[model samples]
Target chain A: MDRTAPLPLALLRGTATVLPRAVISAITAALLRGLLKTHPRLLENLTRLEPAIVHVIASDLPYRFAITVGRAPITLTVVDRIATGADAQVSASVATLVDLLEGRIDSDTLFFRRDLRIAGNTAVVVGLRNVLDREELSIANELEALCGPLGGTARRLARALEVIADSAGARLAAMHRTLHPPGTEAQDLTADVRRCHEEIAALTARLGTLESRRKRQADKIA
Target chain B: MSIRYLELVCPAGTPSALRTAVEAGADTVYCGFRDCTNARNYPGLNFDFDELCAGVTYAHARDCKVLVAINTFPRAGDESPWHRAVDHAAAAGVDAVILADLGVLDYATRCHPNLRRHLSVQASAANAPSIQFYRDHFDVRRVVLPRVLSVEAVAELIAETGIETEVFAFGSVGPMSEGRCYLSSYLTGLSPTSEGACAPASHVAYEEIDGRVLSRLGGVTLNCFARGEPAAYPTPCKGRYVTHGQASYLFEEPVGLNAIEILPQLKGAGVTALKIEGRQRSRAYVAEVVTTFRRALDALERCDEGTPTGQLHGNTEGGKETCGAYQKGWR
Candidate 1:
């Protein structure tokens, strides 16, 4: 099993810190936008009522993005910078955003208790929530493939060649999270996330045992 | 000359409401087209273009005025619909256009220079500087004050700026800053300032669990009511929440703002008009509130006692009444 994806994991844990927050946010936004483009079908399946303006105000950065949709359309704005003219705006941490996208966090319980904020278009935000509902599940298997074991390993030798790029990306992510505190609401939201992680671990163990038994029985039949 | 009987500015959400208000006692009735251009964008409410023109003629024949409320803020790249609503309002020969947006105000001032403009309450222009800014920029003749101000503040503001003020004397209390709030947007992704309806009926669902009705906005539970208790409209600001570990109504309790008992005070405060707030209400509700307030105003003129305090409480969502921020000491 490739278990040592050190760079990205280290970045998420707030260890690597050589890059600036602005550059990191730009890169992250670009990554999300790239993901959207690659997964256009996912967007099409989401919702018919597109907000005219979609604002993304990252709490861990100084930038705010205003995205507009339709003609005389709906506007959604996220305000970490806290400007105006958004249909839907949210303030949360990078980890929480990933967790939310992955279906690891429930937007309802978290948002209602003040984990995230939907500012401009309340109905549209609520309606489109299912779009990002299970994004983490979609990318999990691909990410796991990139994880390499640590030390005295073939993956370690391969990483030496990729060290420059991976290390740089990790450093950038760490620095951005430090600059912005991910806001108070995000703090409240993450309070119960650890419990959820433990629950997922337990479920995974049960599924693994079931798969293993099935494989053994198939071998006997062969 | 005795200040011309305070112009009875009434609200009309439907074509029937228009005639009802005019007949009941409204000197002027304001309404909007059947789109987001108007604040009360409720289903089966407001006017179509033809209906508005006919309503204006009918009101005019009775020597009453018609004011079209195209009050919602226009979206950033698509302001044509709002501009068209104003053009249509003027073309229909309505007395004035009530506006709130800066860009819309600028457009109206230049595009239809002859049109009279009343500032919509959504503008929330409370102080002299804010009131003067609209007056200097758009030549706004009268300002509809947000419900947050007290009678004392209203008097001081009018004295300082000499701007005509219209105070909300009847109907629901909107807790947040009008037009600029996004709390509702955060939960539902639709807003009154832009979509022209807060806690829109489309996204609202009511579920009965164990004999209690739980009102949900966008599927998030807001409040639960007992079998016989009167349920309030699920406005996000008025929804119950946990603040400092105590589950309470954090923003505001769902109550109506009825200022009938303070007619003399508002008149003394130099309010030019008393506005009734239910445009989405039925014609019967319009007639009742307007007729009651009309009689109260007439009583004020003759120095007689009027509707007792708390008389209109049952008309409210929660069967509760507040002087609102009008008596700021209530805070």
Candidate 2:
């Protein structure tokens, strides 16, 4: 069990480099189609946004995903060559993107931290974000559902990925700390802010704590 | 010492948010339809009728109540939408319908008299006479107070009105008269009262220039913040304007109102419920804020060391939280 293992992102980057582009596209397309099939309400909810193409770019990765919302037959496509003139573009690390989907992090908090950058039509972006937030999305649950019969294995693998992501977040925070050590009083303020960001990141990583919610309910019953 | 039982009413923009709030220990969850009939009528937010019915079922099974918000004013010629919303809410079996407009309230009173009605903060019913008007005419059971009233004022109103008083516990702090101010229409032709959104997203924009992010509404620059500085919704009231050769917040700064610390004072004030705003925000926001307040309220009930500390940071709109007018030490 190596703590600080940045596995998921590295694994995806490695697979992208080794696999043919067409094959990767086909796999992601199937997964996207499967997700839509399972979460029909999610697609219906997104249809309220004005018809537009939204680009989601993972700054650390070469690949980008573009989604068409509010139009008949919504589509999600993986692209390497960027398309121009998207209605809105949200660029962030894949981890942050996943957190946004899971609602592990509040988008406004991320905006305040500048961890996520959004460009283009503000209205479309706002609409898209609100629509996505409506769903109780879990990448692990989607994977399990996509793998019928082998769902347990998929669920276990998803848990492993989550563990790796949690540690990778800590490693990134370590790197950030190394880059900015405490200094003069003004710099100390910056350090304090950095610590707050780290705390928020830590809090976000531990968001799936259903045990406490249960405990609170139990306390009330008692 | 016995702590008064104060209900926690929370906002849920979507079906998922409603469930989240319920699971997070909200005594009651309030939501709106996906149309202009409600105040949080943003694109892609809120429930359709079917979703609302399902949400009500989900919440009732868990002993949590659901309230539908028909808080926005209906157009003069088009009262059907508002009227239809009340009918739909009644059909959905919601606990109550929170209303603002006089015409719509009258319709609910006459058409669906059995349905419980609550006065929305949008009505700006800050005084006993105004709240009593809704109570006597509409049979309103409760009134959600505006953020403008002080603790003393709230106690007085509760005593006079003799209605269930719901005060804001947490969320955005608005300075203008609720449900009445049209300062936003000056900037964007869409009426906040009619459209149900202040600075409708279509008219909102953000730009980065010279190391600052400028929030503009209807092409009018509202506030420019340095990189990493907290930004707020570019509504007219929250804007920073240039006056007297100095750039300052002309009306109010972009800050969030957090009254969790003052629950004791409110409970003593004979408040019935505390409402957490932000029906336009994410379900994550709902989960976090609801859970934090739930714990604080639970602790208050047991009279433990209060204020579930460190849980309230970085969870506000303007990136800052204030006690707001509830404890106006400056005033």
Candidate 3:
């Protein structure tokens, strides 16, 4: 196993193991409450939806949550394990889930591509998707709101960090390209070999013509 | 100058869109309930009960009529939802109810006799006799003609039936017979007639592979578009498929219908209303389309030959527009 890969994996596992379920559940519930408060349409639409327990699982992470909607004060409870019975169970990578929540990517596109998997009652899932699509949900904004008085400073710092991270990622990609420069070098070698073969063939053809012409002239003189 | 103006019917997916359409000079605005009562049942679309009521009140106050679309077919065993939708639409005090199903139409006629009923395009009542059946049986005030007729055919139908005719002025050029398309259902196991959604959002997806974008519906790749090429809705009819060892658009190309230039012809053909299709679109789209058409209709009323077709080109699907089936040569 690669040492760098294992380090990140071990760190993620450690974090998952160290975090308490109740703490995560409380945090999730609190965040959801804040989201509902800021965007009342989310809750209002949910009230119109049929009562269902929707299990949202982050496939790449050790995170799962079951949300009970279609009632007053919709609740979110983080589950340590997958629920036995769920009206709808939607699973995707953390990045994908974040993209969906942030409205950066459409869920329907992901669902069709098999990047997002939805099992059990499709109607409930459809209803949930419809309700969520109506609102532009941003976890970053939600987190910033949690910062209270320091929200502006926190947002600025976050933006600076993002810029730095993006540049670093681009640099790393460039370095990677330098290390393994795709298949261009191999393609160039093939083209060079083909050119050499064509040159040799052309020279052979010209030499044969010259010898044949000289032989014909010598025969005429004799 | 007694010039008979064609009524400009526009779509409104939300309450805000309804107001936007009306403000942009829609003579009539049509919408549906938030459920599976009407086509264009995408997620985050349509109006709830309160929204519909408010939309009706808002439109009526401005001398604009609001038509409620309860156009989807009622399921065999359960007709309560359909019945309830009709009741709610009537209670909302809409100017009319656009219906397709025979049973639903009969119920509306029997129950709410005073409410005006327009035959939805979903009924596929293209011919005079079919449209006459609806008028005779259900007392349909107007027939929203299917998008399969030519200008001449529409005129002939109007002349023969002597009933009001509404034609699709703009939107997707549906080649298939309305209310009879089972292509989406075949792929996704969801009926468009019953679910009121074709190529439903839940079953539709987009993926990028090798710089090409592939639109899929229910895991079946419908169309693969080159980079920077306009992508269409992943409907089965507009999909490219292998035929005779060549891959090409088998049914129809992804093109939108825009008949702004032909407003005078449609008016001359005795068309009562010109329906602009796109309730699932944004309020901005509603405003632009309604405003452009309003200008065109105003010009027609003045007997002017010029129309603002160039301004409406950007709003078309795939940035390409055609007078589909309106011109005989388009067939």
* Winning candidate number (DockQ): 2
TM-score of each: 0.59, 0.85, 0.66
lDDT agreement with native, every candidate: 0.71, 0.83, 0.80
Model 1 agreement with the true structure over B282-330: per-residue lDDT tens digits: 5556666777777777767777654434356656767677788888666
Model 1's TM-score against the true structure: 0.59
For B171-211, candidate 3 gives per-residue lDDT tens digits of: 88887999999999999999999999998867866556775
Per-residue error (Å), model 2, residue B9:
0.5
Which is superior by DockQ, 1 or 3?
3
C-alpha RMSD by candidate, in order: 25.6, 15.0, 9.3
Worst 10 residues of 2 chain B by lDDT: B1-10
Q: True interface contacts reproduced by each model, as a fraction?
A: 0.02, 0.53, 0.08
* Winner by TM-score between candidate 2 and candidate 1: 2
For model 2, how does the per-residue alpha-carbon lDDT over B112-133 read when each residue is reduced to its tens digit?
Answer: 9999999999999988888888
DockQ of all models, two decimals each: 0.02, 0.37, 0.07
Better of 1 and 3 by lDDT: 3
Encode model 1's per-residue lDDT on A1-222: one tens digit a residue: 242243233343342134455554554455445545556633442434453566655456455656554333223333346576665665576556555554444453343333454554544554444334313233332333334243235344444545665778788988987886677787767876977898999999999999999999999999
User: Model 3 over residues A12-84: C-alpha lDDT tens digits?
Assistant: 3344456788767666787898889988888988877778898988876566789887787688887756456
Residue A44 accuracy (lDDT) in model 3 = 87
